[model samples]
Target chain A: MAVEVVYRSSRDLERLFMDKAEADRHDKMLELAEALASALQNAAPTLSEKQADDLGIFMARHRELFARAFKNNPEALAELPALEKN
Target chain B: MAVEVVYRSSRDLERLFMDKAEADRHDKMLELAEALASALQNAAPTLSEKQADDLGIFMARHRELFARAFKNNPEALAELPALEKN
Candidate 1:
């Protein structure tokens, strides 16, 4: 028998993950991001100026380094260093 | 001690975000994306031309609508129309 449960948007997928990656799943996220990035390049033919700007900004934030933060635990942002020293 | 299982790099956090979002965690993705974008703009002060170009491209793919595709289920990509006709 299968049981279905409702999930709320507020607490949805947003709650999981960490700074470098999840306790268990980090590689998959990298693969998916790469695939999704490829898809958008091929599928999206046109976008307005602002739309393009949003795209640029969003992509930069999903850095392999910082994304790890989101990967380990989504709430890890609080503990991540505010600045990455070069 | 918490039992720690090894996660394969092939299946990391990268696999999670769909084109638009995820099922239960769609809003979280959006919120976090926004926060992440802001953090990068403030934190990273240097980048080469290629790095900046990559940023522009990645941000475009995370459309609010397409992200919904991810939120519903991560595997929905095969079904996502190769081209979303305007």
Candidate 2:
């Protein structure tokens, strides 16, 4: 079955960064981070306490990457919901 | 600034799978895969042909994980746009 792909974007990362590749990587990383967050959140009720803690730690470890991805795109940054203040 | 995280779900993985942790992991992986797909799509216009090829290869490498994630939830699988046939 063909899956419907949705490309949702509020800002253009390529335009914001001088390095287009960097922007691409950052954009991808941010999306991955969000996906990870959603997965964790959705599974929260069923996750064992240890699994939950592990997921939390995983997020904390990668929080910097997420922050960096958003640094130039405050508009996108504003859209991020799981980013915690470091 | 606080980011608004949107958890959009059409099916519950936990309910579909007898193993809840596996379900959580699958859900998370699927989300990550989508995010990766979006990143690649958004950056396509600017990506060097080589970079594009590399990203495609990366997706190919992980496609199994994605397929496994969607094994039970065909609805979620239907939502996936990047899962190429193997």
Candidate 3:
């Protein structure tokens, strides 16, 4: 079986931010996550195991980040940078 | 049937950022997303409809913002603000 994977790296972050226009890495991540959900809302039935896994990774990462981007947040996001191992 | 809803507002964004701690608003969002995915990774088969819908809305919004928060982003996240309406 294909191994479960995780995304990482500055480049991964850069890829995640690929669609962002500018000055929006924070906001766009949420939006892209939304789009993924929209896709899932319509795609749950047909998504493959691997596809589902991919989406799962995508969504979890999306929410994880969303919850921690507050202005009053306890630590710098730089410490918890995006993954690169995937 | 419950409608396919969207989230909005500064408060929603604030809620989203709730787990963020202090900062970076920029990086924590991604982490939160990952956590959500971890949850999904474990709970997909049993998630309730409303629960799924809520999760969908949450995910979409997350992706949307993520893709837009780049340093060179065109618009500020403040402009797109999270949805407040249920």
Best by DockQ: 1
Chain A TM-score values, per prediction: 0.27, 0.38, 0.28
Model 2 spans > 4 angstroms off: A1-86, B1-15, B46-86
Instruction: Count clashing residue pairs per candidate.
Output: 44, 2, 84
lDDT of 1 by residue, A1-86 (tens): 87654332222355444443342234444334444444444444443343333433333234443444344333444444566442
Instruction: Give me the displacement of residue B26 in model 3, in angstroms.
Output: 2.4
Per-residue lDDT over B1-86 for candidate 2, one digit per residue giving the tens place of the 0 to 100 score: 87553333333423355465656555554444344334433322333344334433433334443333323221222234443332
Per-residue lDDT over B1-86 for candidate 3, one digit per residue giving the tens place of the 0 to 100 score = 87553333332454433344433443444444444444453445445454445544444344444444322232433444344344
Q: Which candidate is the best by lDDT?
A: 3
What proportion of the true contacts does each candidate reproduce? 0.07, 0.00, 0.00
TM-scores for candidates 1 onward, in order: 0.27, 0.25, 0.22
lDDT of 3 by residue, A1-86 (tens): 87654333332455433334432544444454444444454434444454445554454344444334422232333344354223
Residues forming the 10-long window of minimal summed lDDT in candidate 1 chain B: B6-15
Q: Which DockQ values do the candidates obtain, in the order shown?
A: 0.06, 0.02, 0.05
Best by TM-score: 1
